[model samples]
Target: MRRRVPNEVGIAAVVVLVAIVLSVLSPNFRTIENAQVLLLNGAVIAFLALGQTFVLLTGGIDLSTGSNIALTGMIAALATSAGLPWYVAVIAAIAIGLVVGSLNGSLIAYLKLPPFIVTFATFGVAASIPLILTGASSVNVRDPFFAIIGRGALFGIPMPVVLVAVAAIVFSVVLRFTSTGVHIYAVGGNAETSRLAGVRSARVIVLAYALSGLCAAMGGLIVTSRLMVGYPSAGSGNELFYSIAAAVVGGVSLFGGIGSIGGALLGAMLIATVSNGMNVIGVESYWQPLVIGVIILVGVVLDTHRRRISLATLLSRFRGPREAAAAAPTS
Candidate 1:
């Protein structure tokens, strides 16, 4: 039997190779300060990708997560400015995420709405709410303690980085070791079959979207805290794109039910490195999207090919035994 290497190992190798090449090309890329900055900037994308992993595992998508950041972050900023305790404000923001996520889940899971349509509609709604509330202005976060969530460090690591690291570990464990994880994969693999086999596909789907919403809220907090302002346009830009790209590039299938937290994290690192390396090398910012788009296209193509190969192999196995039995000559 041939041993197969995990996709994560290949992605990790690519990350290391890229880092080495960038360091050699750009002296500044090798500095500790640059490394810290890269990680900090990548934190938001990593968090979004983590949540996206859960949803993707359940054969779903979350177009609203980017807008959810703007909505939740603005809410937190407003609550704090209105004299609520920072903790309370944070809680309120998270609650809003849960509500939005639940709404998305209910529509898709219970109402049988398409995931794309539901999330796309909510994306517009979520993005619009913050803009309307602020009258197209950014809200300043006056609470000093709020800064810790994004800027404060623990044992020399940036707070956002530390938070994401913890989240990744927890989510990885949940996906790898829990029965809920099995249900999630089952639902993604074949929703109808899973339902027939006694799995509550609807509930599992809702949970996945809800978790994605929670992660979006966390991303909102970090971005708002780092800037000390809740920009109405926060996360409305490249965030959603980067998140999807990271997950797909990390080996998460577009068809779902096949991916890992570690792989997504490595994908995030690869993206962050490319973005940072480009900036360091003085490449025009306009070219960044082009590069990322190519990466995404390549990932999708590979995923499609892999799926085809797996299907072919499975068909061969199923036909092999039947063919052998037929050749045995029945009495």
Candidate 2:
């Protein structure tokens, strides 16, 4: 039997408490307009976190997510500006993501390069690609279909939020019921064991990075659509940290093989809530990063503690009756 951790519940509690506190402290925080802003902005982080979840589950990290977004956004924008159809531009963006992901995966999985080093190198290349392609300029997106994807609402709910929810549902189902998903967990849990069990760790790792890239590209498209422009430095490095933090905070293990897409969604929402609450309560913009950092520190500590407890519980459950009895206190 697998041992359970309380990280998910803890995160949910924190989110509820923060939302209640923010609502009490600032009337504006409870308004529909503010809610819309929070969800719409949060959708991008949620998408990025979902991708990060996949990589982290495979015992790896992708530092190039922000760069992937920049490059892919520029690709989409440039394609559209060149008289290509909007769908073609969208496909171009995803293709860029897949190609970049493949590069990261191939080097790490096949070449036996360290994930951090490979992704870090790719991060520089991917980030600079947009600058080189556009000479560091922004491109406006004017296609009505593409524009609506970013700005439209369904039944009064923002499209980005809806899209994110749909994606989350699909991913959750895939991770829970599919053979590939099982392979992902197996690979992350124990690569040697998984290989002995006939799982192809290299292919799975590559696919995970590819999915990460695809998600990054989607996030980039949403951001571009919102602003209606593809800025060379659109995502910046901040998003990379946010996506990782969200995955970690939402119960995704940094050590790998233990997380859910639903948890990642909650983590993303918590991040968005914190940022929104701080703004509504009049915190200085510059101080927001400090607040986020503190939250991440607390989350990491809690996760470590949870893992320890889970380990202890599992060990106790496996001990023989006499051994367990001998170890127990006799008050």
Q: TM-score: which candidate is best? A: 1
Query: How far off is residue 117 in model 2, in Å?
Result: 1.2
Clashes of 2: 0
**Candidate 1 residue runs with Cα over 4 Å from true position:** none
- Deviation of model 2 at 130, angstroms: 0.7
Q: Pick out the ten consecutive residues of candidate 2 with the lowest summed lDDT.
A: 141-150
Clashing pairs in 1: none
- The digit string of per-residue lDDT tens for model 1 on 1-331 reads 9999999999899999999999999999999999988998899899999988888988899999999999999999999899888899899999999889888988999999999999999999999999999999999997899999999999988999999999999998888999998999999988999999999999999999998899999999999999999999998877887888899999998898899999999999999899999999899988988999999999999999999999999999999999999899778
| Candidate 2 local lDDT, 50-117, one digit each (tens) | 99999999999999999888888888888888989888988999999999998999999999999999
Error of 2 at 319 (Å): 3.3
TM per candidate: 0.98, 0.93
Pairs in steric clash, model 2: none
Residue 258, candidate 1: alpha-carbon lDDT: 94
Judge candidate 1 against the unseen true structure and give its global Cα lDDT, from 0 to 1: 0.92
lDDT measured at residue 102 in model 2 versus the true structure, 0 to 100: 88
